[model samples]
Target: MPPPALLYALAGIWISVIGLRSVLVEEHFFRKIVASNIFGSGVFLVLVALARRAPEGPPDPVPQGMVLTGIVVAVSATALMLALLGHLHDLEKPDNQEDPS
Candidate 1:
């Protein structure tokens, strides 16, 4: 395997290990967020690796397209979820926001 390909494979493996460890250990909300970040990033790495060896024939548009779509969706979902979590926390303790009643 080429050096770049090998490096990518090793990185992918390491990221997968981190993801697994994240699951087995303590799972606080922040930790879970970190894990999600790792996992989504790992998937992106895999897609990139596949793209590295992508064939010239017949075009590999599908894989590229899917990865691009996934990146957008994952980023949006993560941002929304994090925002919602923060909002929930704020709701739990409304120090700044005055209560209506």
Candidate 2:
């Protein structure tokens, strides 16, 4: 039987590949943003899997810390991307105006 970590690593790699493909192939900006988030999540999962190298001992703290930090960064980046997307959407809308008589 394969170890749990190996399974997680494989899943992460698969997810990352899928996300990357979507980011490259999708035409919409929103879809690209979502794909980027998925890619980040997959990377975090891989990091977590790597951290669990020693089953007998406690998992390494460094990778765990890095993952935590990365999560925060990812969230912030996603928020920023969403805000930018919203701004772009607003800009694309046809503005309605009342002409002064």
Worst 10 residues of 2 by lDDT: 90-99
What residue runs in model 1 are displaced by over 4 Å at the alpha carbon? 1-3, 54-59, 96-101
lDDT of 2 by residue, 1-101 (tens): 77789789889999998999999999999999999999998999999998987766898899999999999999999999999988888788747434678
In candidate 2, position 42 carries an lDDT of: 93
Residue pairs clashing in model 2 are none
Off by over 4 Å in 2: 94-101
Q: Which candidate comes out best when scored by lDDT?
A: 2
For each candidate, what TM-score against the reference? 0.69, 0.89
> Whole-model lDDT for model 2 versus the true structure?
0.91
Model 1 C-alpha lDDT per residue in residues 1-101, reported as the tens digit of each score: 45575577568768967876785685576677778778777777777666666434453566678888988998897898799878987988878777689
